[model samples]
Target chain A: MPISPPFRMEAMNNQSSEIIYTYAGPRTASDTGPFVKTRLMIREFIDARELIIRLFIRNFSSKYRQSVLGIVWAFIIPIITVGMFMVMGNAGVINVQGLKAPYAVYAIIGTTFFNLFTAGLTACTGSIVQAGSMIVKINFPRIALVFSSSLMGIVDTAVRLILIAAAFIVYRTAPHPVGVLIGFLSLIPLFILTLGLGLFFSLVAAILRDLINIIPFATMGLMLLTPVLYPIDNSSALGVVTQYNPLHYLINFPRDMVLYGSSELTTGYIVSAIISCIVLIAGWQFFYMAQTKIAERV
Target chain B: MADSVITVDGVSKKFSKSVRHMMLYGTLDLTAGSFGIPLARNRLRRGEFWALRDINFEIKRGEAVGLIGANGAGKSTMLKLLNGIYMPDLGKISIRGRIGALIEVGAGFHPMLSGRENIYINGSILGMKTAEITRQLDSIIDFAGIEEFIDSPVRHYSSGMYVRLGFAIIAHCRPEILLIDEVLAVGDARFRRKCLDHLKQLKENGVTFVIVSHNMQTIDGIATKGIFFDHGSLRYCGTPGEAISHYEMKMLGNDAPFPETLIEGSTKPGSLRLVKYFKDYGTHDIRFEDVRITNAQGEPSESFASFDAATLKVTVASPSETKTRMYCSFINEDMTVCMGAYMDISLKTGIQTIKIKFDPIQLTTGRYMVSLRLYDEYLTNPYANGHFGYFSVMKGGCVETPGTNTPYCWRTPEVTIA
Candidate 1:
């Protein structure tokens, strides 16, 4: 092999003798330097993917073990939330003239995709503090915690999608074939956005635990800000706000991808994709920097 | 065994007591650090203290190094630094190979998960792949002796079962570099023997180890080298025996080489505490005429608990009011005092009784000799001074008692539970 142990190690006299090791202060600036840090972060993620899967299995299995509800909690909560919105819509408290899809199909699809972002972000934000014992004691890439929880989000979102399919069966209608393809594809950018936001917020959550209490409450409000339960059109101020909201494009694109085949690739969709990439980069940077001190902080 | 597996250089790490200030200043440090704007990190900000200071050391393949220190002496911090749990503020540390640290047993075990599941998670956290862990699954269960309860949620497992399972997974990982913090024994005698044997077997297979435990027997047996730290600095490094002696001598503040009769055959390594008896052999330049022991409540007691604070009162008689040094040797019935603490004093011509108090006696439960010895100014001539009669150190009743090693008064502040 061309790679025979590194340069400095070979220069050493022999194995039996004491090999002196050295450490220096604040090492990141010595690098090119952020480039190396980014590369290492990606390398760590790939190298630790097995560990991530292990943690994911541990979390996913333990989450539903022995409880009566079991995996039903994944579907039940979204079912209830969508059920509440449909109840209001049926009572004439809300209007649906601008929408073409059934409220059951529309609401379930929107909430399922949005749940990927909301649940993934919440779990990711809380994962660091939740694994404080391991973070302080074991030496491994801390990103595994975020990755595992985000994977759980994927699993949960998949289960919630089944609820959407079950709704389609109940309604006796089929999803637009092209829409289903794009709808599944849309999950990718949503996950990237969730992971990015999760990495940054998780660090802050480890420090100021008030973020833990604030996240679930905040995500509930964020659902309104996105076009999850409502259709985005040019009418109300809420619609205007939704017009500017990138999540409206991100979440709606996927939901419309499955509910109907004609999910317009708006200029906003391109912007949302760009934003997701930005969040991922920023989150990875912040998480890596904060990691050096997390053992002490947690 | 083929490579230099670990390197640490000029490393220093500081910790802040206040979380709020740490978050604020940490942000400042991170930003200032990224742009090459060196924030004066050397200076301790408010509520910040140096946990590890400009320390440097290294380990080659298959060498076992033991870390010894008083509480808050940064032994655990150094271990954390080596493990990459906490990066040093000043220096860099590079550890090659898959590092498996039993720094705290069950470090990542989810209590809600079953014993079987936790094994996978813990093994993976130690850097094992799923296929590797699966191959070892039966062995892990067999080592832990938890086959029947493998499917039971770990929350339902007894504490002994919990630690056993944790250690079993760690031992099976076969890490090339192992860093263990004070996990000498987790269960009864059978389990203790099993754990020690596993460590011995691992050591024989050419694994490098950095162990931090106050258990001298473990150090004397398993560790080839010992790193003695005091307040975050590398104070002494030598053979395990010499390191223990040096550490003990430093703690007592006197390093008078013991008379040959004292420690000749006393260095036997094992669980058996080799209690030593010193023959009275010095011509009297100064003499210890009387001595007394009292507990913290001022009760004159013959025995003290391991955690009890007590006092030693000594009266010295001398020919002249001359410059002299006084040494008190605190000995346990099982193990000899690794070293004695000697105090410098000017004696009164005839007799002056001095009262010295020990707040929270740092000894495991056993009979002890708070032996008083006197010396000439330069510590040449020595006398028995006086000895506290066979007062027992009763079992310390505290949550800090681990019951296997000298139960903690130090390192207790830094307990990171899994």
Candidate 2:
């Protein structure tokens, strides 16, 4: 009898050939019908949480790994920036007028909050691109990459906030009880806003890599436009600009509640917070719509 | 019952080249006097071209399929679509199970993290739960063969070690559908064999697999079905043998010319001629007729047996005026060089030639290319080189399976005893 050909080997080789031809095709709209199933989001969220923790650890370790001071450097830089702002403001080189709290305390709080917002935003914008190979090779929620990078920034922000509070204690400034409450409460809106903006910008950055260059300039312009250095009241153009700036509410609402014991949220704060929610939803919608194109575009 | 676990229908993916080019133009548009109208016209004229044209396929559960193509044949783009990294621009794809891919091993691994840490991180990326990773962690470590260095930063691991760890984690991920892309080619021989064996085990367990490889031997060895892609389209989709033949045909066109006449020799003998050939050591200035073939028993024969001990003796002539440095190479029928040897012998005038002999050729039964080359003392420059001749080592002794009509056995029937 003729020896039978190696059936298993033949089968394997044939299967591989089929796969080569299988992936070739043009872009068609994906069927989003399956997405209506509620269980998908729950699974995605659980997966995202794991990814977030992993990313947070990686970001933390990688940032500090080769540095001389390691993790201590995280606390040192923020302290220096806060101290520089304090010294400059107190010596009359930088003026802080029309504020209810001491200038150094107010500046520290503003810098801490703003730093968190900008760092999260900037890091999230590059996350998708930096993780380009992963995004393109594996099947996972692309949103995880953006959210995880933002989470890393949040961890840094939390560390800096703790250091600021310790400095306040050392300086003999009596802690306001409301400040603690505001700190926890503010994270909700801040997270919602950052997640939305982060996802949107990450998508944009992946498609148009040059946006990476534009992001820093935009954030700097935004910092100058907001009242991070000086407090804004109703009488000034700066106040009007701050009222319109969504990030201003994220920063000032917590500051006001913490330092000044303001229980009532300002009308501008309420309006901007609503806008922030809308912006976030809109960003998510935009990302959801554009995500299908990301693999091709990137 | 639908055996197809993954179905792709009329899929086409298109990308706009002008859109990518216009990114550069935007900076230029900043300086140009008129940016609006030209940019608008360019955008309008800039249309889309499909990277993947109309294609359709159904992959059954447990099937191991191979994707074969030249560069830019849309093989990678297809893997991306299957992984859900890209939605097809025009087609619909339905997948039934979770996909675990090793498209680029260590794609998401952080260099600063320890190998143990990266396993957790990579496992999560592959959609494995923490509990699952914990349970399989030991297996991953064992498979990777880096237990001693698991805690060291992955940045310190060699590239082979990194790939092993990455692949080990992926293998233990227990994906229902697996997509692999050319990752095996990066590892060494032993590691490659380990991965192939692991993949075979996985296939036996009914896991569906999609693989892309440029190595034809690998495709022949592992794939159950095959697809041939050309210029962003599926040129053929069927059996692996045919696909491999197609690929080989494409490759051979550039290197091997079809013989005009069956007996006609190569026009430029330098490409085909064999000047000097030798194997092993000791014997020198030997002739072809004196070269004896024998079984493991050391009995001399014209045709040697398969999987048996054998020896070959060859003689090299070092003409007085010619350079004495020479190199010999042995190649299989498929034109792959199996092994080689090099030596230099500077001879004075009046010497006719040198005889070289090789004994106990440790080779399996097959046709082989015995080629030779003469070069300078440095061995960098070549003077003359090509295949000297071809020889066959038979599959068995003459007394057994006598006068068999098997396709390859016809040439040696004369040696069989009644």
Candidate 3:
């Protein structure tokens, strides 16, 4: 096995022979067709693994080192949001219903899962714009930036998962053993959907500065629409809109598995998993094609 | 063709003049590109102009190619294209080796991170592996000359320290092809010399170089070949000397020939003759008609005895009234300027002669060249400059030091007892 440098994927030839990179007339890697380009992109990603790890370390360390609260900010944010919603429930501002488990356990699990999508989406969307200087100066694989930022999101979510674990212990709520495993497996689709949309929005957000400002609000509104804080009201008109929301099934399936050990939403989960895969494939293709123009605009 | 590491063939690039059109067209093009819709790339749309129009060049392996042009002459665009930061619109560019660009070093440095930690991050961004960075860690720190502050956060580092560390990391990457912009003039003068020496060593070790600089002396020192760009078109590509002269002529907008051919009859009784090789640049408000060195006997001569008095007479032709200063510098064969003299002159619209006398010209025995530069009264803008000729100084003065002379006397020592 050859130990090539991590920034560039070598061509088929060895080091002695030259590797020719020809760029012409607004063309890019996708001109080779989607399948071949995707294969090449995978190889480039593999070659850029070390760079991804380094960038992740850089972002992860710099982000918390400057803050007074440090890593606690990750858990504190969702904890506060959960506290506010509980206060509203106590005040009778909103009705909390349809829970076999305690409302604290239910809401904490839901917020943790929901945060995986929202934070991941936000991080991925801003990755390219935040790395604007590096993008213009260097010729490294751009997908590495997204991957590193996505790792940050995953780490953030992992921190929040600790809060969920603490909530379970504090409430003495016993989750179904088999359901725990199934609930963890269900997070795969949610993560895939977040990364997929992140790939799309990151590129678009880099071009349009307005999307950078619009995304947090959009995801906040999405959280309300997806029933992340409360049980879905099936009889309400707003609940009808939730029927088409894929995040509803992706987030709810995991929570239902831990609470009920099985869910009637399995069919909906399967459909949403397929949708997530589709978004991922399409978003990857779009990101790959448009990345070559990024330096010029940024 | 196999030996050519970089080949840019008929490449052209365009940019939008207005920010609104740039965003609009960028979005439209991006959308069209994402949808796989082929648009007319060769044609320019509204509010767009060609930044580079049909440029063609090839750089062979182990060659140092210097790129020279005025600001916004597409030199930077060409460098960006070569580095794969931008794709061409009308032609193709092919490059064959791992490239290390010193275009803007320290661009990726995180201010909050320690210098030692940022080195690993910047090294990886430049394509060095972690193991490689670890191996070169001590050397990088040594090269940056900041061992004491390596662990300090770069936010506290001086700007000079920041660039030094950045350059140190990239320099150790051992790239096959190196691209340098106007970044070599960083840090202090000693550090700048160190960088140039290192670059020279790299060149000897067969690292191909593409340097873009406005400093002609630097380009002439390093570049085996020079490419001059004017108005987005390649105006000349040849030897470094010829390319620089051509570029300088264009910059001054002068039509006069550089290094005028030899002539016989111009030498008069009391005026010195000029050598065949001479370079001159000016606005033609005033021109050097004749330049000569006269010995103590008051006759033009090329060879002077050491410790003898000499007069440098410069005759100028001016078409209008102007006040300018003449600066004449004596340079040895090593091209080191030994001594210089200046005269402030106000000339009317005619030919006139100005003579500067040097009493006891004490330059040691050697051959030396005379360069005359005419500047405005404040000595800021250069109006004309020329190396008129060279003169020889023969052995006559007391044998003393090897460098230029300063007036001195030795007092007779009196015997004393303490």
Candidate 4:
């Protein structure tokens, strides 16, 4: 098996080559052509695996170059958000209710899980445009940017998990090991949803460029609407919106599965999982349609 | 043909001049394309024009081909297409082997990363394995001559250091094919000569190249074949010597902007083809007509000896009264301005003759073009300009100059007994 790099596909001799024969304008088969053939895309992913990991490390390492706190900066956001909510609950500004664990622990875990989605979506969506200099001059598998940028979420999640572990130790409460395992598994749906939306928006952002401004703004908005800061079982019109929101299920389902062993959120989680899968598949198709022309635009 | 690595067939790429319009039209094009209803293939939408059209060629493995053309002739676009930076709208370009392209300066290095770290990042982007970069890391640092500062962020490095590091990383990639755009001036004269020598050495090692440059002499030395493009169309394909001559002739001609159709593929070696493009002076402004160069005897000549006096007789005609300052610039073949003289002369409404003389033609054995640029009194906005003609200093006893080919003798100062 030859481990070719990205852009190396099956040649004419190997899988009939992308171009089995030469072509001029309007080759007879162009209209019927797959926007991006699945086999070719899969091969590209395989070839680009090394590049993806390298880029991920580059992004992760360069991200905190001059910061004084460095990787510790990852813990500050969740801790700050949890602290603010705890203070609000004490002041009687809003009732903190329905979290099965201690409120501080509940908010910390929720922020940890929610960060996965926000970080991944932001990374994936902005990767191509941020690396616009490399994109325009060199030709490599562009999808590498999508995967590599999204990988930053996994890195951030891992870093923040240490903070969560520290939180559990301080609280002197342990969740069911099997339920925690289920929580870990939920990362699949969460990652898929983030990656899918990212791939789709990358092309859109490349065109409008200003569209990326909305991604972070929108993610911040989604945080408040979802169960990141508060409990999910609300009794107002907010409950109606939260009930239908897929992100609501994604944020709380696994956290609930681990902290309480079970919650009335199984169906919502499954539905969110299915929707994420569809989004991932469809998003890749859309990314493929735009990927070839993206260099010109960027 | 069997060993060919690049095949570009009937490729045409169009670009919109306006960015907002490009975004809009690109959306419309993609939306229409999704319906399997092909959009208009042969029409230019608003603000849209063809950057390249009907470009066709092939590059066999191990062949170093040079691309020569004037600015905006689509040489850069052709290289970009081959590098897969731009997709062809009308045809297919199949390229084999791992490729490296050095398009612009700074080689896209991340500002926040150290030179050492950016080497790995840029190398990975260029498709090199981490293992490969590790293996070549010492050599790259050594070649760039920045080992001491390699650990510091490249953002703080001098502009020359940045270019050196950028070039060094790409040079170490060991790609099978290299596509270089015209940003080759990375450092001082000595560094440029070293880079040129390195490029020649790379060619000897069986790496293929399709480089675009305005330096005909560099192309002549490095390329086995040359492709000449004029206004997005391939005008000629042949030996580097002939294509360079063809390009020079077109520069001097007075024909239609660029002939729609071109005589494609090789002409005889060192042969010249003149393509005259004359822009109408139109209802206003000045006319630079009839330029004559004379050697020592005052007879018209195109070749001169070193340190020989020469005079340029320019006949300028203006329809309306205009006070024009005449500037005679000596330009090298690569179009680098060497030395120039300014004359604060006023032109009458009709034809007036002006003579500017070079006391000693202080130049070496090389080709040089005398550009007769007519400027307004402030010497800012050029009203009319063209190359008067070219002259050659055939032989010389002088030592080679440092920064240019224009000859000057070496001077040795007397050493005191201090």
| Number of the top-ranking candidate, with TM-score as the measure | 3
Clashing pairs in 4: A11-A17, B253-B276, B253-B277, B254-B276, B254-B277, B254-B278, B255-B276, B255-B277, B364-B407
TM-scores, each model vs. reference: 0.74, 0.74, 0.78, 0.77
Task: For candidate 1, write residues A40-158 as lDDT tens digits.
Answer: 67777897899988888888877887588988888889889888988888888767556787888888888988998888988999999999888889888788999899998899888
All candidates in order of lDDT, best leading? 3, 4, 1, 2
lDDT score for candidate 2 against the true structure: 0.66
Would candidate 1 be rated incorrect, acceptable, medium or high by CAPRI criteria?
acceptable
Runs in model 1 deviating more than 4 A are A1-35, A90-92, B1-5, B30-37, B250-418
lDDT per model vs. reference: 0.74, 0.66, 0.79, 0.75
Q: What is the lDDT of residue B365 in candidate 2?
A: 35
TM-score, model 3 to reference:
0.78
Those runs of model 4 whose alpha carbons end farther than 4 Å from true positions after fitting are A1-36, A91-93, B32-37, B250-418
Superposed by TM-score, candidate 2 places the C-alpha of residue B29 at a distance from the truth, in angstroms, of 20
Query: Can you write out model 2's per-residue Cα lDDT over B266-380, one digit (the tens) per residue?
Result: 3432222332333333233322222223444545443443434444333334434544566666666666775566666564444233334334343433455566665667756
- The residue-level lDDT of candidate 2 at A113 comes to 81
**Higher-ranked by DockQ: 1 or 2:** 1
Query: Could you tell me which 10 consecutive residues in candidate 3 chain A have the lowest summed lDDT?
Result: A1-10
Q: For this target, which candidate reaches the highest DockQ against the unseen true structure?
A: 3
lDDT score, residue B57, model 3? 91
Worst-scoring 10-residue span by lDDT in model 3 chain B? B409-418
Interface RMSD of 1: 8.2
